[model samples]
Target: MAKARSASQAASRSKQARKPNSLKSAKTEHARPDESEGTVPLELQQKCLTIFRDALRPSADDVAVLQEVKGHLYNRDFAAAFAKEEYLRVYASRWSPSRALGYVRVLADIQDHLLPDDELARLGQSDQESLEIVCLGGGAGAEVIALGGWWSVVTRSMPKIALQARFVDIAAWNDTVETLHKQCVTAPEISKYASAAAREANRPMLSGDAFSCHFHQQDVLDWPENVVHTVITPTTKLVTLFFTLNELYSASIPKTQHLLSQLTAALPANGFLLVVDSPGSYSTVSINGAERKYPMQWLLDHTLLSDSQQKAGIETAARWEKVVSDESRWFRLPLGLEYPIELENMRYQMHLYRRLATKGDG
Candidate 1:
């Protein structure tokens, strides 16, 4: 009888724990439909639309506040240089200044593969003989030094070696210079190498003369035409592209091909092009295709490089390999207030191309 009573109590508890069907039916009746069936209040819908419109609009007050803050942090003379559209594009994006800094850190890690100390020593000796080295899309110049430490080392070896270092970018040229200065002052290791470079260049350590780094503020498409004719020589050793290509819109692929052709045309036999970009694993949008994929081999076929350039390029090319082939690295952000849709499957590739030896070459 006691066991029977206990079993009865257990059953009673189970019944109490279960929701009644009548209650479930009531909930179902009140719940909103998955599809809007013109049942939603028009006034409520209009209110939501108004809120969204306001959210989308950039307020002048907010702009003023942001500008004041940036001016304080950077400098008092800082003006809103970028267009409102461009500013919104960058500001609304998930890639904030902090994210950009994180990306820079990742770039630094990858650059480690490029200029191992021994390689720097060898490259230094080569530079002493007047090897022209140019960095394309050199953002902030951090990756340039981090990967091409050989440049600094070579400068130290041959102070009189005429080295032409050109930094190319579309915008933020002054900001890049400021960033380089900040890094030189704040980052001790980078500062040491930079100081050494200045000494080798026969410039004063802390003077503006050390700021001889050339800045080219031009579209990448125009780069080869504008600078290539003037700067490129047969002895040009290295050309680098770091973390800049991914920012390009996918529609610019043809433009990219044109740029590659221009680079190939400019580079002498035995010159090299080193490209580093987000891995293909990152998601990208394509206008016609489902998702964009980085065609690395296509880029390789487009460029000119020698055997040695190809070898050096490959050694520095591993960091971006995973990004080009992996799908996991790519993701889509929300379009305004909409939910994030899966980005069309897109991939990235990093490449190093060497110019082949010319006819009658040794």
Candidate 2:
């Protein structure tokens, strides 16, 4: 007889089981459908289960409530230890796939604009190139896996460029990040969402694509401004922050703006910042004794973009673009598992700020 799942596991599985299956069954009409279009893939789920062994154990209602309160009000590294275990468990099984879809969508948009003609062809033809990416508050590393997997899928028919990403968060999640890296770059069987053809045509990217990640367990707010510039090269550099800026801005808008100022100042002429965050009031906290929702636009226009009058600022020549999504589908499968995250009807902002090249920029 098979062993039974604990109450928490059963509950989590039950939640994931509720995912829509109608679209997933139309495989005949879909050849290499985007992974965002349906539900999570089977191989992907099994891989997550295999890699992240930490499972969510049931806790008392009072303890759960206290922990939830603490998470909203306290520092992330100091939050409940048991909750972190549960979080990592949920992250591998749930949040990673959802966010990966979003990343792929935004990436597709960027590719369409940047490389309108033969994007995949260029991906395959380009010699090995390196990029340095810095992701803020990315301890669990869902975003890193997403970027690598998306690159693999995007260049499935071609060769992949080299990528070296640095993740900064309060927790030391390098082990989990490394495990995810292995799955994306070397072990491709588990990361199905990367290549849509993997499910339809049964071809996974080979292990030699060469994507690596580094981890830094430090407070992003306290990070030195020029650190990213110091570590990057002449390659196409990028800075990413997913679902993190809201918290920083909530704590202090000026601090968040300062961070942006430093990052944009240090960005090379071709460098850019990509920020993905939800639009809501639920994640809000008290700022100067007044409860308020996340201020998305003010930060973009004021913090990220400087006034044209300030011609001396590093970001004065930069451009900011924001996209709000109501519904857009990628590839997902009906796996009948509940992983404690709402994967549908995503409502968030995808913001990109690129530094325009200027003369005398070296």
Alpha-carbon shift of residue 63 in model 1 (angstroms): 14
lDDT of each: 0.38, 0.50
Give me the runs in candidate 1 sitting further than 4 Å from their true place: 1-129, 144-150, 153-163, 178-212, 223-226, 249-251, 281-349, 360-362
TM-score of each: 0.44, 0.65
Superposition error at 64 for model 2 (Å): 9.1
User: Distance from true position, residue 27, model 1, in Å?
Assistant: 48
What stretches of model 2 exceed 4 Å from their correct place? 1-78, 81-87, 114-128, 188-208, 232-236, 281-294, 310-345
Best by TM-score: 2
